[model samples]
Target chain A: MKFGFLMREIGQGLSRNVSMIVSIILVTFLSLTFVGTAGLLQAQIGQMKTYWYDKAQVAIYLCTDTSPADACPQGEASSDVKATVEAALKDAALTPFVERYYFEDHQAAYDKFQEQFADNAVAKYVKKEQLNETYWVKVKDPNKSAVIVESFTGVAGVEEVRDQRSYLDQIFSILNAASIAAVGIAAIMLASAVLLISTTIRLSAFSRRREIGIMRLVGASNFYIQLPFILEGVVAATIGSVLASGAVVAIVVFFVQGYLAQRLPLTSFVGVDDALLLMPLIIGSGVVLAAIASGFAIRRYLKI
Target chain B: MISFSNVTKQHKGAPKPALDAVSLEIERGDFVFLVGASGSGKSTLLRLMLREEIASRGDLFVLGQNLVTIPSRKVPALRRKMGVVFQDFRLLPNKTVFQNVAFSLEVIGKSSAYIADAVPEVLRLVGLEEKADRLPNELSGGEQQRVALARAIVNKPDLLLADEPTGNLDPATSAGIVSLLEKINQNGTTIVMATHDVGIVDRLKRRVIELRGGVIVRDDKKSGYETALPITDQVPISSDTEPEQGNEPEQANEPEQGNEPESRISSTDQAEEQE
Candidate 1:
């Protein structure tokens, strides 16, 4: 209630426990930075998932002369076999799951193979007739590729049904593990921050026990005595929060944007806007936790 | 005003109650002296009056509010109407006299304008106006106790409780502090002072309530310490025999009286020791 007096007391308390306060700030900063990093990593993972899953397709390979004899018992897929596969893709039963499907004949496949191996010597020996034709089917939902795979597998002309998501799944699992590790580290750091903040508050209260005793005798309410100590923790943690937000923003700007985004142009990365969005959450949590820790810690000294 | 009806205070882990079946009434504008030896419950009585400790049995009332069942949240409001001083004169060592006195007002959320005026006025009353900027360590024992006194009364409380406030002062200096208390009491602040100083009690001849072994041995209207001493000269007895058995060791260890010179030297040393 007494703003000036509380401010003066907070200032004095912070100054008296300068070393403790600084450690609280540093710990809060480190912990909240990890929190932001974890959040940003999850966001980036989500972005990449959206980008890759949207482009993911189920490729059904048709039998060719060079295909394994077990898959192509007739030695090669005839025109009628290609026609049957195309009709199955357009069937009314599969319409809901299929977004679109394109036929890549042996000629188109050979052209892509040649371009892919333009610098290799084998590009000249591979003939168009030997390459298997593929039906590239993009599904509405990537996870729904199971329906399309079940439909074409072991079919008369199909050699293999391949979902591109299988490859992307490996990448995502690695990123997910990274995100989880960041969160685990953030959790540990935050716990340390809470303990450190409470210790700092306890030490401050101990050093000012005489003042607190006098205040209690003079009819100062519990809230009146605790506000300054709570504010001391809040102020230090807020500075840490701001610094963490700044670090998160810089990470997005420099590492995500300038480095990762530049080097890995195909994959989407978390941006500055995402980091800015996380600032409030990071700072809010820091302030709330610090206030609670200090508030609870100072209660032992305010028995009267 | 404070009233205790058959009040009993039993502290945890103690062999006997701190106060047993004590009843007394202190009206508004009365300066009452609670004189007792160590562990005789004088401080406990004062503490109960301030609501710092609750009576284990019987009803206790202060300023017309029942202290037994009063909600803890309302305790601060009750305390604001009273001031308390201790034997140690607990002044913040870093603060100057002005700041130390102003601190009481500040704690109760008084405006700076009121504090600026009231602090100097109270310091002037305690004869510390010139030493407003001096730290607690820089001041003498008498001056430090006066600052504590000034801080206690700065809020203009309805009652003042002093628990052995002059215990650490010399005879002459304790006289000065008592006179200051008398001046404050004259201004209509009910004062309840707990003390072991027989010299002050003998000199003042105030309303003395003496306790021995958790029970009142004497209550006199305008009586000196000699009139209150007949119970101690003979074998101490209690309405119940149990407490009398516990009083033997306490009575035997009672500090010898008429040792004002030694006490005066220790008072100065204690003041310096705090620094």
Candidate 2:
């Protein structure tokens, strides 16, 4: 019951089972690290969805004089054809789905092409009339891109209807799959951690049974007798969680912010601040798991 | 301080009960010797008094608490008022003699200053003050038993129950240990010693309770180890048989006696050999 004596016993127990304790710490670290990584990946996906979804577009390109697309049967789109397509986009049924739209003419497309590929031989060969005129449509619901693409893809004067959101969805699903895999691995590793914690506690209890019996004879309370073994588990698991938290912080600080942030500027990523929020949950998991495992171990093995 | 009324204890599936309908009273300061042969219920009676095993039938009480009805949570509190010594000496091998004694106090939440005061006092009582820093393995058998005694008595319990305290020592060392128990008892602790070493019991001439097959066959005041049975009864034959069998092995393994230069040199010789 004295703090000094209790601390000494706990320290002795930890040292005696150093190898087992180390395994518990490493397993807990591995499992919780996976949990933290999965959480951050999901956060990154959420950030990307918010930043990119509002800007998703369906770009319907008009035919040009030298168009390579099969749908562009006419040599060039006339002003009359442009008016007809614009009228169809503004029709009552399609109007509700279209938030807004803007047109890019042959001259504007040629200017963009010149700026993007100024040194290319293809740009030197192309004329302003050869460039396509495109309509960039903003939608009321980003998920409704299929409706717009399907309705206008083969329409006369249209070369192609490209939904930019489809590309982002593909990327998001891949990230989601990775997160699920991380969670699955975390579950298996956490099971190993829990088993190791309980086993370490049980072994300590058995090895000290003679001492425990003496204490029982001398009237030491049940709590006093069992405190050291339980503390063994709690201390090991907490150490693991502390290391795992540090690993998560390092990834967010150095890898995500320092490295990936610069390389992938097209999307928003989870920052250190978001990862820091998970520290409490990570440490709490360690503490609660140790407490429960040791509690069950003591109940079954220590019998007090 | 202890009483049993018609108590019976049965080991599950064993053909005979450990104790059967045994009623006896041990008052506050009674120094009683539990004398019996193997399987004669001496150890079982001691275990019952310690509440290690409950009475299967009838009422058993020690230190004013019913052994059966008392909640398991309160067992430690009840046990704290009594000290117990075993044949094996049960000292923590890693701890020094001083720490071993201090351990008993620490378990009951004694303050640091109290432990510091009480531990050395108990060590001194056991005449191991000079060897307090020595670990159990470092001490001789008698000295290790002394440390176990110091540990048991440190908390200053009201009852001291010793199950074969000198079972592993020479007669000379056993005599020394019995004197220590007698000293503690004179200080007002009730002593209940269960032992088959007949020499000390006969010399002490204390209350002797003899048992056979769970029944109390003899309970005598101021009696020796031999049951105070009538000469015509069959007990004398059994009592006569015990010394021949029990005392022979003890005499054969009697290590050099007393605090002589002979004993000291041999112990040091042993310490060197171990190293």
Candidate 3:
């Protein structure tokens, strides 16, 4: 029941099995780091969903005077054909899918293209008459862009229908796979951490069993006998979790926010606040995991 | 004070019960010896009193708490009332004699000041004050047992239960240990010691409870036997008041029952603080 005595015993336990404790710490650290990384990756995915998905449009290009597509069979879309396509966008069957629609004239498209390719040698040969007009459509659901694309793909005067969600799907799938891999690695490491904590507790308890037997014979309570051993596992796991939290914060701040943010200004990365928020979860898991491991270990290895 | 009412402790696979329907009453300040052969249930009786094992079929009252009904969680607090010494001199190998004695006080939540004052006093009581700093391994078997005794009685327990306390020592050393038990008994602490040391039993002439084949073969107010002899037919279980066939002496020593060690614990704690 003396705090000083229990603390000294815990210190002795850790010192006697330094290598085993270190391994426990390292395993917990690695597992929690992966957990934090997976968390941050999920956060980034959420942020990208808001940032890129909002900007993801379904672009419907209208045929121009010099258009070669079969849908533009008149060499250019007639004003009547353009009017018909515009009417179809507002038709009751397709109207529910479209959030808003904007038509870019041939001249506006020509000017934007010319400005984007201002330094290109082929720019002078590209005339306003050759540019295609476009109806840039924003859908209520980015995932449902296929519905809008199918509705307008073969319409007269429409050259092509491109859904930006397709590009997002490819990018998100890759990110999702990477996140899953991080979680997979984290799961394995977490299991190893639990096993290591249990082993550390068992070895420490076994080594100090003579003292434990004396304590029991001398009328020490069960909790008094078990505390020092449990504290050993908790101490190692806490240090491991702290290290993992540090690594997580470093990755979020230095790598994700600083380096990646600078390198990819268009992409949004998880910030330090998000990383700090995930810390409680990582640290909590470390504590709870160690507590459970030590609980079982003590139950198995100690008569008390 | 301890009382066993028809206590029967039967092991699962053993041929017979370790203790069979035997009643016993031990008073405070009584120096009693539990004598039997290798498997006569002496150790089992001590363990039953300590609440390490419960009575299989009957009630046992030790230090006024019913051993059968007491909650298992409260066993440690109950054990704190009495001291137990083992054959192996179960001392901490790494701790010096002083620290080893202090360790018991430290565990029961005694303050540092109390531990510092009480540990040396206990060592002095056991005449090991000079060897207070020596580790257990450095001391002889008798000295180590003394240190163990010091640790057990440092808290001023109401009773002491020793199972083969002198088993590891020589005859001379065993005599010294028996004298220590008698001294503690004279100081009003009851001592229940189980041993096969016939010489010490004959010399002490204290109350002897002889067990044979899991039954109390003899219980005399004052008894001395030269060797373990089977005499089951001479003494019967129904003869609680009747005397057995022995050169038994008429005695007039009876200890008052119901001395609560919990009160003594608080007083000792306060005494440590006051000093």
Winner by lDDT: 1
Where does model 1 sit among the CAPRI classes? medium
Judging by lDDT, tell me the better candidate of 1 and 2: 1
lDDT (tens digit, per residue) of candidate 1 on B97-143: 99999998899899999999999999999999999999999988989
Between candidates 2 and 3, the one scoring higher on DockQ is: 2
* TM-score (C-alpha, index-matched) for candidate 3: 0.84
Q: Candidate 3 chain A vs. true chain A: TM-score?
A: 0.87
Instruction: Name the 10 consecutive residues with the lowest summed lDDT in model 3 chain A.
Output: A69-78
Please report, in order, the local distance difference test score of every candidate based on alpha carbons. Answer: 0.86, 0.84, 0.83
lDDT of 3 by residue, A35-73 (tens): 999999899898899888999999988787777756678
Candidate 2, superposed: residue stretches over 4 Å from native: A58-99, A103-164, B228-275
Looking at model 2, give its docking quality level. medium
Give TM per candidate: 0.92, 0.80, 0.84
| Model 3 residue B226 distance off true place after TM-score fit, in angstroms | 3.7
User: What is the lDDT for B182 in model 1?
Assistant: 90
Q: Tens digit of lDDT per residue, candidate 2, span B1-275?
A: 78899999999999868887889999998899987656768899988888888889999999999997888899999988999998889999989999888888898899989988998888889999999899999998899999988888888889999998887876667778888999999999999998766667767789988776677767888886554446215444335433432432223223422223344344334433433
> Per-residue CA lDDT of candidate 3, range B1-275, in tens?
89998999999898778889989999878999997655667889998988888889988999889989998678878888899999899888999999998888877778999988999888888999999889899999999999999988998999999998977776667777877888898989999998755566766788999776567877877787433334444565524422333222111001111213343344335433433
- Judged by whole-model lDDT over C-alpha atoms, candidate 1 comes out at 0.86
TM-score of chain B of 3: 0.84
Per-residue alpha-carbon lDDT of model 2 for A161-275, expressed as tens digits?
A: 8999888999999999999999999999999898999999988888788789888899899889888888889999999999998999999999998999899987578988888
**lDDT ranking, high to low:** 1, 2, 3
